[model samples]
Target: MVLELHVWGPAFSLPSIDPKCLAAIAYFSQAVPKDAWVLVASSDPSVSPTNELPALKNGPTWVSQFRNIVDYLRQYSDGAWDLDSNLNALETADNTAFSSFLESRAQPLIDLSLYVSSQNYWQCTSPAYGDLLQWPNQWLLPPRIHSAAKARTAHLGLSALDLDAMEDQRKRDHSAAVAAGKIPANFIQRPRDTVSKLLGRTSHQSQFRLEALTGELFEPLEAMLGGKDYLVTADRPTSLDCLATGYLALALVPELTFPWLRDAMKSKAHSLTAYTQRMRHKCYGTAAVKVADAYPSLSPSPSPSHLPWQTPERARLATVGYTLINSLADNTPILSSIRAQNRLRQAVESSKADLSDVEREALAKHATGMKKDVLVSVAAAVGGVVALLGYMVQTGFFSHEGEEEYEEEEEEYEEEPLEIEVGEAPDAFGVMGL
Candidate 1:
């Protein structure tokens, strides 16, 4: 079967600005059979199911969204490259929670960086759209996409804070330049430009939303990552790892014009940088060279740790706990209902002596049905907890007894680096003759 992925053309010397596009590339690189011919193409809104790029055509079927594309591929391949196959119930829950967190929190920052940031838009993003469109469309579409992106960032509260920060910094810099005799002291600063006024309307907001989001999301991600080879405790790369790798690889590029966003990403725990580099080497070979070329000054040197197919370390209990809590919170209604019912049952049992026969029967009938509900809920909860504990124990989360063996195997598995070549052009469509 022929599988084709449609995405935005690449800009800023990285892959697509859309994180999902990068994600689709990462997923297919590892998931599909090596011999399978999957074409990645650049597409406009007209061809997409939701008028968005990153749509996938699998044989005669069309699928949109990264998650849906993945699901379709899994089903088509009969569960080949199923990243969550080995995850126990708790780990699965943890994966789902973390994925949702990344989507809601980190993804917006990416959109802001690409489309909302003035420098990035003019220099990197708009030109990308221009390259894929014909004449008037080249002129017409970028602004619309930019406007939509800005609207999205505004909705998420990222655009205003960042724009204000940029405007404030620009004013400061201009003042400093004048004080140092860099420009004529008598010369007045230019009035606020259109972009500035557009983006800086809410300048009074005290905190930087992007910084807050970065801290809120990256702190836990960094802690969970630690020194592990992948995001989860799996022996091989998983879908979550693909997503994390794609988002980080694209975000951490030096050429991105959002100074605060770039600095914030760089300030993340060193392991994140390390993991991105490792995944880049493993999943994207020659493509890494192009991305590095975009930011020659900040390009990382090749490291021995870029070896592919090494076993991943088990996740920490702290990471597991965070995942569990987030997952449980996501299911708050079920848990809350269960708790309320339990309390009601306790009250009814304690006050049984004071109840009339009719009241007793009514309470007993309610209790009988609740017992089944409670049993099912309790069973599910207990099973999840027990599976998590079992996984923790199996991985030696609490001890180092078998760590030496894992280390030995890790050493033994190291070999000549395997090269998985991403498309030559940053935009896969260009390579596919789209």
Candidate 2:
């Protein structure tokens, strides 16, 4: 069977927008032969067991994350698929340590640049996510991921970079202040961000902090490379190379409004910059996905010419129902709890919300849309409750809060799953091809 290496769709002229996805691309390019597998831009986290991207599928077997995918491939192929098989025990240990270092240290920096920074997120990264995903998911996933990033990096003491909600509020306040009367350029008390006024986060300090983070990650990596083309060894690439490439390529490549991460990498760490560029080019060169229809003629690009990428399996129908139902179930409670417009803005930033509009008109529309969603969700939930209560009342099938069971009811569950075999799940349920 042809193996499916499912990942997020490409953006910014990169193989995949995600760093982890990039690592998988690099690993597949090096380890898996062109004939054995296909790359898929599924662009839906719901398709995976772990609810993450860069998943590998072989029949019923499903695995995700770069290191896990490496192990899965190696074991399934019975050692033939091993990328680190050439490394000695010591080298392998080093390989493991570096992978950990990359994920833990390098990841937060990427999050900061791509998701946490208000300007970068609003201008570049969020739009990329919107383009990469389909309808409702386009609205759902970006905010969720952005929320996750903010939580992950909260302790880093860079709250200024993360205040997208407050940023919009400040813009509105400043515009109102300006409309009241135009101020002179030389005026010392010009309208400024309230949060920034209180916290006093300067760009110079943010840059300095960013540079320090880059050094912490890149210094060790550069020291290890020591002028070599690849990390861990000079001759060829390893899984470590794939991970580093994934993390560093993302840090360097994406065009961000606040490009401190990219700037720090370029200005401070020359060696790392070169190594990431090299790995990205070698591994993700001219990468294209396979489709049923041909571009120029009716043939998928074959072999090493383009890395073997395939059209992704459509999202299962069950997934769509779950997403819609789940969104209503999840969002309404948060919406109901909110008491004020400021609190509502905070809810969008904190909860599994996605809309982050850069423009004033768009931000207003986004707020209105969010309010509508909340009302719709609340109505649906209330209607369902009313319907259920009516049925219970008519049939006398329910009891009061302190009432005992009407009878001893036997607990039951389906012995069989919704369907067997995860691979054919989309076919069994239904496929939503974009």
Report each candidate's C-alpha RMSD, comma-separated, in the order given.
35.9, 25.2
Q: Please, what are the lDDT tens digits per residue for candidate 1 over residues 282-349?
A: 76554533322222233355332211211112335664455446346535866656655665566567
With a 3 Å backbone cut-off (N, CA, C), the pairs that clash in candidate 1 are none
Candidate 2: Cα lDDT at 51: 68
Poorest 10 consecutive residues by lDDT, candidate 1: 304-313
lDDT of 2 by residue, 22-116 (tens): 89988988988888998888888768765678998889878888878988889888988788999999998999999999999989998988888
